[model samples]
Target: MTFPAFVDLLRQLYVNVAEHEFALPDKQQTDSRVSLLTGVHRKEVSRLRGAGAPVRVVPDSVSRTSAIVARWLADPQFVDARGTPLPLARTSEAGEPSFAGLVESVTRDLRPRAVLDDWLDRKLVEIDDEDRIVLMEGAMVPRGDGEVRLYYFARNLGDHAAASVENVLADAPPFLERAVHYDGLSEELARSLEAYSREIAVETLLRLNKYANQAIQNDPGGSSRWNWGVYILTSDATSLVAEETPENKNAGGETA
Candidate 1:
């Protein structure tokens, strides 16, 4: 972010905290109190206060598309024996696992053709030689637009930061936030390990996704919400290297 944008965000955050976390006995959120706590001027606080709380609403298109794709990827009828998504016909008149049925199973509000058209425009899906609709690889991962990608970026990073921060501040760590870091590995070995991790991560995600898909269908009116995500990063170590250990120095003593 540019320095000005960052400052604006920080200022807004401070104002929110002051109003919600440090309210007076009369329940008034005073600008003077916010200015004192956040080092923002009282006048700036008053100006921002008029904007109300920060908006956290997810776009309808993003939420609905994500749900539909999740079900497509996870629902047993939509996948083959090897768990790959099966190419679907346009409607149930063609057969089971038709694209129209797949969409209606999620929500009757959106027409299957509309979703298909959007997906085609976004390159999220393609038509096969037989005229079946086939999901494109990496379709689940957001791409092509800064707005969509940035939404996921903010959500995943924000949740991770929230968990890590809660763990540090709480007397007992209530969140799961753990990682293993090893240095001094040859680039080849590091890449191999990363591949293995990716393999395992995908398997875990698919398993949980299937379970969650069934769960939401069973409890469609449920009020609670949850999120699960995985990430990996690799970079050159700037600090002094330690001796590489092991009987089998390979990734977990195995390969991907």
Candidate 2:
């Protein structure tokens, strides 16, 4: 029989147990119920049960339906006789999205530097691979002993397209220090950088969208731009002056 038919039979059995307030049928009775509900041979039910088909029983008549529903809900591998996982309602945490916990779990098991480097490499490829640009200067600045400051730059022939490339750089993860500095005035090179810049702008806008969505869910009037904050550090006695570049300016056009 078709998979859907098998599933229907299993569901009917569940409903029957729910309404009748009785234990699920024994093996022989189960086979008979399958044959009656799905028009499949009793032998088919026996075979499926041997192959790990889950059969649950209600222990108490007073709350039989609730008990059966709860059992089905708790079992991650609970499938119908046809072998489809039953859909269950999902509950999200107060401050976390559905996949946030999974992401954190995976990241926690990885080396921080390795993860950062790998993600940066992917972003670089998206920005430069097709345009034949070569990444020239790249470094992961050590922030004390455990943190890093990632920086990279690439160069290409003056005429490459700029849109998608720019987006990759701008939308890169927040840990990276990103900028596009012009090296020469050739028309082809300038066009490529322009494309890179535009793409980065697009990526930034997408990041803003994510931040805005989070803000709305967290606080009704929270500012989307407030989703991220900046920190500035300086040496106590150095004579160095940090000037903000027009292109690298954040929301306030100031150095951080």
- Candidate with best TM-score: 1
Candidate 2 residue lDDT tens string, 24-55? 55533455665555455567645654444222
Give the range of the ten consecutive residues with the poorest summed lDDT in model 1. 247-256
Q: Total clashing residue pairs per candidate?
A: 0, 12
Model 1 lDDT on a 0 to 1 scale: 0.77
- What C-alpha lDDT do the candidate models reach, one value each? 0.77, 0.35
Question: What TM-score would you give candidate 2 relative to the actual structure?
Answer: 0.19
After superposing candidate 2, which stretches have Cα over 4 Å from the reference? 1-179, 220-256
lDDT of 1 at 174: 85
Model 1 residue 167 CA deviation in Å: 1.0
